[model samples]
Target: MNSDPDRQVPFLSYGFRPFFLFAGLYAVLAIAAWTGWLALHDMPGVWITPTFAGPPQQWHAHEMIFGFGMAVVSGFMLTAVPSWTGARRIAGTPLLLLALLWLAGRAAIWFSAFLPPIVVAIADLAHLPVLAVMVLGGLMVRPAPRNLVFFVFLALLTVANVMIHAEWWDFTSDTASPALDAAVLLLALMVAIIGGRVVPAFTRNVLVMRGPSTALPRSFAWLDRVSLASLAILAGLAAAQIEGPPTALVAGVAAAGHLGRLSFWRGMATGGAPILWSLHLAYLFLGLGLAALALAHATGMLAVSAALHLLAIGAIGGMTLAMMTRAALGHTGRPLRVVRPIAGAYALVALAALVRALGVDLLPGHYMAVIYVAGILWVAGFGIFSAVYAPILVGPPLPKNPPSA
Candidate 1:
């Protein structure tokens, strides 16, 4: 829109622009496809056979975590590393290529029935390492110990992904399920780590600006360290397929630690701010979800699927949407406040998580109905995001000094 000859194409100008857009759209479409395939699977005369590398459920899990989840992670890392280290941003051709690599992985997985397993594995596995190299380049510019740990996260994620693909390649028969669990835990850990840093910082900034604040967010405290450490241990146990009392103990400790850590943040005081409260709510889910997971392991009161949906849909989905909306706004030079529709989108996702996680358990007779409701809510939330943010992301940034009102 600016028509400046020297400006990069607006969508390719920053990592967040295209990748966030893709993440939003893919979140909607992928879930929709999964739900549709599921609903039509038993219907007579239905012609909806979708071929995937694995079972439909595995394909759903894989794409949501590896495909959709990684896109958001990639976008955030690519955008943040430059900011954190004063390095040049990955943009233009390199960024475009990176985006295409992610898309290719999705395509190869969706149509893997027609493709060689080796080809599918290679195509899918290539994106993360290239992303790691790009992120490492920027981290090397400054190289703080705190920042460099993310490279390790990327490496672990790659290993988890490989574990999943190994099953497809006949390297192992039973690794995919546990590996998927590991991947989810790793992503949750990232959310916990990043959320710990930003949620309080942003909340404090808003609180201070609004008025003098008696209580501000307490971060990087003893409890925070305990929380992260416990979650990391849980992730390790998951990767190794450990079960029973030990995993339950760690998960329970992690749950208490995170919830306790959250209480120090003063989330309730951020009244009427969707951008702020959505984050708090997502963190709340992270804590509660872990608690549920611990219960699932220790007592036979909850289904594992319910606990996982709480983590995957509630914490991961809600946090990513909140961060994506907030980041897209700030980086694009738009106001940091969220519009009403986006606010409703936040509520929709939270409700979707609750319904998906607990609905069937509550009303066992309506299992399929509950699934349909949850999927629709999930789709609608991201549909709103994609529609609202498309123009903002693709358009040139607002002029720093606009014409006087």
Candidate 2:
């Protein structure tokens, strides 16, 4: 790979370089603070400002989705789209500008009460639009021969944020609060779409690099269409008020489809592959989360509370950490291995999901404890990745400079 040409290069000479590092590090600190304050009742609900919705839930959802989650997406897109299109890397001041905008949004939401609602709203909605511009800009400069239209999903994510902002500003009805749910579903849809391409491709790349004898399974035919269609329909249903029966039916089918798709990835076989397992475990949460939500509605046995946690904490949080860590390592010219502590981070997340899903009723008041643990594990995982990979994201190039030859 060619060296980055920017003059203001620090440790942030690449997109994933700084954003992934800061994002991952922030993942630990933000969630820990969030979980602790919530658990200990140390922080007031009004600690954050208002916009579309109350700061309480807004703070939580925004950080998880756009803060931690969007950071991961930004890192991946900035890193990958350049490679895909042969475009110049986004680095130095421009990258910092984007990161600061994200941080500003987090701060505005955190102290939203002190600031005008419009101020918070502007800062909050700024990151994704900036990101969409950055990504779509790549297409304009040097369009990827085939993946030009992929920006549609990134654009859709931006649209989802518009709905989210509508709720923040009371432009929508009282039911507008559910726009958060719509945003979550939209995030899930993006994960399914992009994760579908990258994880398998990366795994296959690693296997090929190592040797043909170690090739991961390659059957990706039905999964692409089925998961996409299911999520698209689900996204629409999530936005509108659909009847219970149709909702239940779609949820059940999505769960099954996700699970069936995941099975082909051979997660069990990839236990030794930290990069692979991180991706697999994240995907597992997606499948299990869909199933958990479906079963919740179908039987009325579990509340959406547990299911949402499963998706947010488990699927979204877990996968973002996993993918960001993996991509950061690879693109930064580091080995693909997750250090022991980082791997332990994954274990902590798995335990968190189990505790959150199974323990809410079993150990009801301990939600804070589970959340605290989850936040700690989650943050620690990303924190570890930041420590290890920040150096690699900058720097010149790999020592040996070997491609998958």
- Report backbone clashes per prediction: 0, 8
> What's the residue-level lDDT of 56 in candidate 2?
68
Assess each prediction's global lDDT (C-alpha) against the native.
Answer: 0.91, 0.72
Per-residue lDDT tens digits for candidate 2, residues 217-293, read: 56567766787688678767777856366767787788788778777765676767887888888888888888877
True lDDT of residue 318, candidate 1: 97
- Which residue segments of model 1 deviate by more than 4 Å? 1-6, 45-47
Candidate with the greatest lDDT versus the true structure: 1
* TM-score (C-alpha) between model 2 and the true structure: 0.87
Q: Quick one: best TM-score, which candidate?
A: 1
